[model samples]
Target: MTALMTAELAWYATGRFYRANDGSLADYGYFLHLPFADAPLFDGKPSETSAHFTFAATPFKADGIDNGALSLGLDPVGQFSLYLQRRPGATFADPASFAQGECIATFRRTSLVVGTTVAASLTSASGAILGTNVFSARLIASNPFEFAGKLYDLAQTVGMGITQFGTAATTPVAPPPPGYDLVLPFTGSAIALGRAG
Candidate 1:
């Protein structure tokens, strides 16, 4: 048998939970609404509508912990897709045209990304590491499209970092590892479509 030395990253061992304003756990990973651009049609202009996009979060396993806190990384290894469910006269033949009857536009694009984050703990005065922070970088490419009879490419970069805050009081817990700390709260932004080679 082969000897194996496996070290599990903090982000994998410890799960991150998110709650909405009403305190319900937020299920979806990423959420956004993107509007379509106007295009020239046979008679009238192409219909303009918005597509709802959603992405689920998945963990990127790391090698090991350095310094004191745990480090987690994110790359665009996950899948990305889009949905357009409401359009006028939309159909497969004339998907985005006003004369068509198709109401949905679906596409899956190829993407990749790379980034790192530190897990820390939250304190009344100072902060610590609780091994629940997540950081990541992502590069996404839109499905190739032909505009004006020419092929064009579109891509995007997304950087994200997140941590939790607070803990259940009353349940006295043991101190974490020597350098480990508590969790902090964070908000992040996303990138849609960008130019790519």
Candidate 2:
């Protein structure tokens, strides 16, 4: 799929649960959001009018936490889903842009574990693959979540790394909010589009 060039904030992460770090339940996964260039979301965030993917995750260890937008504010023990939203309404079941007839897309991961594949598909108003992102996720958690992307390639949006939400940044079982991190340290090729996310 095409990259959101104007969306300056790029999020990075690395996740692993249930696994003990040196006999402790401390997680090495982290969530960090940083400013990036060359991507656009049409109407960027921090603005009233915005449209982009809502990155979220759900745990296999839980019993159905939340579905779409609800999961963004729920506990960190849920599966991950990317919901397309356009602000104004910018809400669950009814994103603001849904009424304006904006493009809609959905991204989901199979297992909410340390490593897995995240598949994303962009469709037209009638549901067609006429547009998209090349983001493919890596199935392993590592220190310093690496965001490998090639800016020279317009079809490169596939990045690898663990992405934790609303929870401990480095510790899996830790608390939330204070440790929210989306690590997208620009390596120039941090967003590899045209692949899988």
Candidate closest to the true structure, highest TM-score: 1
lDDT of 1 by residue, 61-176 (tens): 22333345434322333432322222323321212222223212222223333222344212221233332222232333344343334432322111121111212221113332
Q: For each candidate, give its TM-score against the true structure.
A: 0.28, 0.27
The stretch of ten residues in a row with the least summed lDDT in candidate 2 is: 116-125
Model 1: ten consecutive residues of lowest lDDT: 7-16
List candidate 2 stretches off by more than 4 Å: 1-37, 42-51, 56-79, 83-88, 92-155, 159-197
Model 1 spans with C-alpha error above 4 angstroms: 1-28, 32-51, 57-60, 70-78, 83-187, 191-193
Candidate 1 vs. true structure, TM-score: 0.28
How high is the lDDT of residue 75 in model 2? Answer: 16
Question: Across residues 78-105, which tens digit of lDDT does each residue of candidate 2 receive?
Answer: 3233333334333222222222432221
The true-versus-predicted C-alpha distance at residue 16 of model 2, in Å, is: 20
